[model samples]
Target: MSILFGVVFFILGSLIVYVFQKKIFKGITEEDVVCEVVQKAFIRVKNSEHNEHKLVRELLKSDAFIKDLSLTAKFQGSIVGYILFTKIKVGEETLLALAPLAVLPKYQKKGIGKSLIEKGHKVAKNLGYKGVVLLGDPGYYKKFGYSSASKWGIKSPVKIADENFMAIELYPDSLIDIKGVVQYPKEFGI
Candidate 1:
């Protein structure tokens, strides 16, 4: 029975690691995989220009791109998810913009998106970034502690629902006194 239990434990450990595999996104070589995941993830969104993959490509070449904050999740060594945090300006301070977070459709709802987000937040905090902003679902992002940007006096550069525009400070009160319209890279065209 002990041997059987040991075997079960080992199998479970391997499965966890396999499903949660993540790493810094290597450039160019892995671009296609990342783009594919982005497009696939947004395919079902109503009127999703479906050009998020293009945005990812553009962000990669933009000055705002942070190489260290771009991450990928893998399954069995194949890239299955991607997330990017790019530099954005709020007032005079530089924070982050979380964009194009994507997971292959088949891989959705399995904690992969949450894992990428938590991992990105950790890396951003380690890199000294105080906060991040994004345009996304209120309910989904709220799970990660994202709240209305308006609460921090931050406004959206474009006209957007207050709830859809959100921000999260990496640490307590990190976004205090940070108030302004978020300036996304021109690549965003917004």
Candidate 2:
């Protein structure tokens, strides 16, 4: 039908216009912008904390904060995406935890989140991190190399589905010997 053909063209058009800037998040100076991005990104999620901006504020002040792993994606001089990977405890090893990755509602999909994750992984690998863990949609995260945490004996303190609680090694065999319940920072209130 003509309507179906029109829908296809619209989808392709949106993808063609998707582009953004990504860089190490400027701490303190850009905190409010990042908070605002987080707010708008999750405005429709029924189970979202709905106050994730507050969590980001607390995490920034926590010892787990990692300046280099904090990244933002900007489009046309305005921040449109943000991703924070903080330090977390896994038995004796210290790994990164990716949380609250946000992309503005209007900008969702179109590879913004994908690019941010790829960049974060590269930076994390260079920083000598073993891997990154997160609770997110497995279908999406898996496309970026994430797998069930249980595959490496990693468990979450809070109950969650195996598929939703996922992780990705930064490099080959990085998590081969690591295994334990993740100890999130106090800021997470877990």
In the range 1-190, model 2's lDDT, one tens digit per residue, is 9999999999987766553212344344689989999999988988887988898989998899999988999999989999999999999999999998999999997899999999999999999999999999988898999999999999999989999999999989899999999999999889
- lDDT by candidate, in order shown: 0.93, 0.91
- In candidate 1, stretches whose alpha carbon ends up further than 4 angstroms from where it belongs are 1-28
- Candidate 1 lDDT by residue in tens digits, 40-154: 8999989578999999999999999999999999999989999999999999999999997899989999999999999999999999999999999998999999999999999
Cα lDDT for residue 140, candidate 2: 88
Q: Write down the RMSD of all candidates, one decimal each.
A: 8.6, 11.3
State the displacement of the C-alpha of residue 120, model 1, in Å, after optimal TM-score superposition.
0.2
Q: Determine which window of 10 residues in candidate 2 has minimal summed lDDT.
A: 19-28
In terms of lDDT, the best-performing candidate is 1
Q: Looking at candidate 1, what is the lDDT of residue 58?
A: 96
Lowest lDDT sum, 10 consecutive residues, model 1, at: 19-28
- TM-score for each prediction? 0.84, 0.84
